[model samples]
Target: MNFKEKIFSILSNKEFDNLTWNIFHDQIKNNITYKNYLQFLEINPFEIKNISEIPFLPISFFKTHRIFSSRTTDDYDIIFTSSGTTGIKSKHYVKNLNIYIDSIRNSFEFFYGPIEKFKFLGFIPTNRKDSSLIYMIKYLIQQTHKNGSHFIPYHNYKDIFSNQNDKNIFIFGLSFFLLDFIEKNNHLQQNMQKNESKNKVIIMETGGMKGKRKEIIREELHDILKKFFCVKEIHSEYGMTELLSQAYAKKNGKFQCPPWMKVYIRDPEDPFIHINNNKIGGIDIIDLSNYLSCPFISTEDLGKKINDNEFEVLGRMDFSDIRGCNLMTPHFLEC
Candidate 1:
């Protein structure tokens, strides 16, 4: 079966590991950037048997290098760019749009049922055009086929929540914009109360304050969001421009990845040694769906694994470019 089919059908850890190995082999053979990275480390791809032994390409390389694990370079369907609000932006060249859409849909469905059952309302500011989050939200809104599902501009909080006919409402917005929405609209509780008895409202933050506000801890931010939105838990989407797959946190700021995606924590001082579970360290991800680019990516975020299947993103690495989704916390330095 093709990777698109195999990725969604992953049922066991063994199957996922086996597929990751295959993807890694392909990446080493076809992707020049990854091959060079591995070569620079003085590691032979053939000697690596386990998934843990495979060296993940640093996510910053996406900004500095053209990472494509494909035979040709001209078949890019879409290029997803990062917010870059802090510094240089990272760009992910998606060879097939269908793969990305499939990953988005499957991952979303894995966490929160099907997209058709919810009305998606995006509150992302249109400061940049090539945003992967905006594209994903737009696609989800289209899939819902709901009447009031649309993108709302910044500072223009329209009365879109008035006539929701029993469908769950999902408001996907950036961290700053969502905060701005609640701070400016004091009557949000009253507006939300009208539908509270009938429809479920889910406010999901896609991280990043974008220099619009001071950076705060995720727990504090979630607490503010939960109280203002009248929701018990504030949902979060953990993703970046460099990744095709996304992890979702339903509650308490604990994120769970889909079957094809796995998260690992590595020691910050020593990038090669992966720390034990519940240890706060740098975040490393293995996204099998990132087959076109690089599947394994060592990110700049600091996180701790709750268990084998779940993790928590505490903040970014020290001095790293502040980006979307993951919050920034100085507590990581104490680790």
Candidate 2:
């Protein structure tokens, strides 16, 4: 099967474990990092029958190395980097933009519905360009072809509120931007209550304060959103630049992975050891959609498995050792 067909079949099939193992073996054989990691662990890939036996590459590797499982490249179609106040940004070199686009489109439709059905409104508080989130939003808007689907700049409430109609509306915003928008448009709360429009409005927050505002707990954030939007639940998008796949949270901060993705909680003390369900540990992800890049990644986020298909992101580890620092040279640091 071709790449797209294989991924689609894996997602649609009920026997995910077998499908995942097959993909894992393929990755191990093709990916240099995976091969090296397996060698370092002194574990033969052929001996790894269970998915838990697979070792995940530390997420920091993206910062220091060019991470691609398949092709070596002198050029990349697009490069996505992590957002941060300080420290080296993790760069994801996308060889084929189509793969990333396919992953984003399929994952969203998997969780929510067709892209054309919703009027997407994206709000990014800052002016930073080349954001994967921004790119995804722009793609969604273009695909939707709805009159109201577009990116709103400077919290243009007048334009947004004026355009609100019976169509299903989805507002994608960064946490701080959403907070700012809601605070500035507090007067709309009562108006929203009275309008009684047939449109099912969903406020999906792409989590991150981005050092722009004081960090608040998810509960408080959701409460404010619920109060302002008059919606029963708030949705969230959980993703990073390192991986192609995304997990979504409809409500209550519980995120469910897409069929092609899986989350495993690993013991922070021993990164190789996978922990049981409901136990707080480091988050390790297997994103089969990331076949071009490394499929397995060990993230710095602290989280626990809610079930086989669901997980909750608690927070990041406070004192985790920085991984890619060794590769930084004095001249690079001076710059």
lDDT of 2 by residue, 46-140 (tens): 87767777778778778777777664645678988888779999888887888889988989998888887888888774355557887888889
**Per-residue CA lDDT of candidate 1, range 30-142, in tens?**
99888777766778989976677778777877776667887677789888888777777888888888999999999999989978888889988765668888889988988
CA lDDT of every candidate: 0.82, 0.78
In model 2, the worst 10-residue window by lDDT is 326-335
Identify the leading candidate in terms of lDDT: 1
| All candidates: TM-score | 0.92, 0.90
Q: Could you tell me how far off, in angstroms, the CA of residue 142 lies in candidate 1 after the best superposition?
A: 1.4
Clashes found in each candidate (C-alpha, N, C closer than 3 A): 0, 0
After the best TM-score superposition of candidate 2, give how far the Cα of residue 270 lies from its true spot, in angstroms: 1.6
